[model samples]
Target: MQSKVTTTKEKYPDKPITFIVPFGAGGAMDLVARILEKSAVKHLGQPLVIINKPGSAGTLGWNELVTSAPDGYTIGISASELFLHPLYGTSRYNYPTALEPLAQISSTPVIMVVKADQPWQNATDLIAYAKEHPGELKFGHSGVGSIPHVVGETFSKSANITLSQVPFRSAAEAVTALLGEHIQIVFINPGTVKEYVKSGMLKTLAVADANHLVDPVFANALTFKEQGLELFYGNQFGVVAPKEMPADIRARLITGLDAMINDPDFKKDIEAMGLQYEYLDTKQMQTQWIFENKKLTNAVQESGVVELIKSQKQ
Candidate 1:
């Protein structure tokens, strides 16, 4: 049996692997997939063919991914949406259970930002104005089941403010709307708005992280906790396969992914795109998944994000 297993592993992945990206092309997720694809050829001895199946706040693609055969030929990228979609009835499977986590590639801390012309200078000013005006202020997010949406809602709840929540197909879209003055604020990844923030087109208010970002552009930014809200959220990107994938196959994929992420060129590419490189092995990724799952469960429930999603549909 052991020899057979070894032979099977050695001969596995004779064909190209389909990498399902649940978000649109030109987005952060797509970029990550492309970067991994470059490294896969070296480590896995097989090409990773990226397929974009973006829609329905990422559920459309993730649904297809979770239902794919567990033969190791089809794998997908996992983000906060993997765990979040289930909470709001947008997904068919619970994350970290329905899928096997291979490795964590990167983490992008969620940040609050406003148009440069907005009246609020910092989180304090924004929260104070929000308290005064209630739902009069509007904030845009990627989608109902995205990290930005959940973090935005949680921030609202923690600050006891009723800002009007706006949903866009992608974080880029939300940021665009913010620039057009269609919304007053946005909860997004700092890297996405780094250029705008530097050019004085957008202003970052607070980051939903324990420590301020080390990026010199945002090093001085304060955390939501420092602004008197206990909100801390981030966007974690990783690789996953169907839960029932054979242990041998899973091990092979993990080995490939671990090697791919550790590549110096891969790290450089991810950092160049403004994403923080924080690689976690399978075991560490699983532990982090559990912690994030519990925390997200509470954030979703306490922040009334489900109710918010339901109301949006209605």
Candidate 2:
């Protein structure tokens, strides 16, 4: 049998590797990619270059990765929204079977959050109060088909509430809207705003993980299950390469990734950044990716996002 990875490694023993990031700088995805940049260099023996191709909700980079030569040299950082974006954007790119997973780094629970100064004390209070008010409660998201919007919608439908949903352009903008009291609740990454929670600016009501939110600050909050609701979901982040890459090369890449995730220093870096570190190497990543792909489909069907994208197609 031919040694694909060995051949590629021998051919370009010192060539720098490229890691494509399909999101804007300063965003959570970008931050995680940059962190990996610091730790991945030693493993690859050459410098790691990150390319930002933020458009079509991360489909542009996915498209680029699919078309690029799969010699184990090029890979992309794929995240939650990318799995669902093409279904909402008029993009011609998507989960082409051409992409292969190297590993999954971590998972973050979508937390229903409100300003610390807000009147609602927990998810129960928020849901109950909204039941009476209906459409009076407002929430913010990155946009119409964003994860936050979908989470809020699912939460509302499951909780039997009608909170209004608002869309923003970026997480920073969403945070501003939340801080200015423009929206009553927001679904946000737990890591991005941990400081705000620590500083008492944002109060987390519930985490859409299980029936509980483990953080001490949220110990008093009520989860959907506790409130007699049945909805739970969040986001994940991982690395992927083209499926055509030789199996040997793919294995080496995943092995290196597994080592990275287990590195104490790397684990500390992600934790310090307020992001959770959940490793799902090769097999697990493949399973998780497939599951989330179905979710994106279901979300599109329920949200009419795929139809919206089709209508916008030129």
Candidate 3:
């Protein structure tokens, strides 16, 4: 009897691809997804549907992505919290085994800002006040385990000050509280506060980055490192799929996304939105995921945020 031969054929993305944004509409993640949808659809030969599942510090959408079938039709725009969530004990699945990276889209560094009339002029003055009045200064962040929260905690550890934390539903909300004088400080992306900074409603004390930002709005602001605090923080956005996706399908998705990242119109839109356009292939993104996972794990542990989170829950 002759044995039957078998061959695996590739059929992918015949229908609309669902791109999950783990945040509400009008946020950075949502904006990124909407901006790329047209170009990505054109490149992939299918419509890219954006589904917002905002909650659990961005893990809700990630959970949706990981739980979906590994068919390359369902993917998500993930942020740094995807890795930090598991460290904070908020997620059941970890990054390494739960998701597969497709491409890194962009990154926006966090900026430390205060109300325009606040007394502190720069990072030095703020740190000095915080050091002298530990537990008196209130800093606002989007959520407990969000990148801005981690940035605040990291600043506390690096600067040796004990500042109080105030969590809001989103960065915009936190900035609103800051504007109302409900909070003394807020760590947020420049884009969210760009108009306010330009309008003189907010003062950017320093950026939590290693290098100076290219955005003209922050040209005069110094980095936290420049201010003598060895600290850096930012939000990195990327695409991820369910683990064990077919190799050919993953390659197709990556190719389409890579093209979208390099498109002139897409780049212009991202810059206009005050985001830095940076692209990383699948391999590079995987390396970044691992490196960031380790780096943030240490930061979270050392900052004692894990304990703080547990206490808050209690």
- Find the candidate with the highest TM-score and give its number: 1
Model 3, span 54-171: residue lDDT tens: 7767777788888998877898887888878887677878965698888888888989999999999888999899888878899998777889888888788778888889987667
Measured on C-alpha atoms, candidate 2 has an lDDT of 0.73
lDDT, residue 133, model 1: 88
lDDT of each: 0.85, 0.73, 0.83
Q: Write the per-residue lDDT of candidate 2 for residues 194-294, one digit (tens) a residue.
A: 77887899988877777454455555656666666655667788888877776666666777677777788887877766677788888888888888888
Per-candidate TM equals 0.90, 0.83, 0.90
Worst 10 residues of 2 by lDDT: 305-314
Error of 1 at 226 (Å): 1.6
Between candidates 1 and 2, the TM-score winner: 1
Candidate 1 lDDT score at position 245: 84
lDDT tens string, model 1, 90-166? 56677658888889999989999998888888899998998888788999987777888888888887788888888
Candidate 3: clashing pairs of residues: none
Pairs that collide in candidate 2 are none
Model 3 error, position 151 (Å): 1.0
* Least accurate 10 contiguous residues by lDDT in model 3: 1-10
Q: After aligning candidate 2 to the native by TM-score, how far in Å is the CA of 27 from where it should be? A: 2.9
Q: Show where candidate 2 strays beyond 4 Å.
A: 1-8, 11-13, 86-90, 131-134, 211-221, 295-314
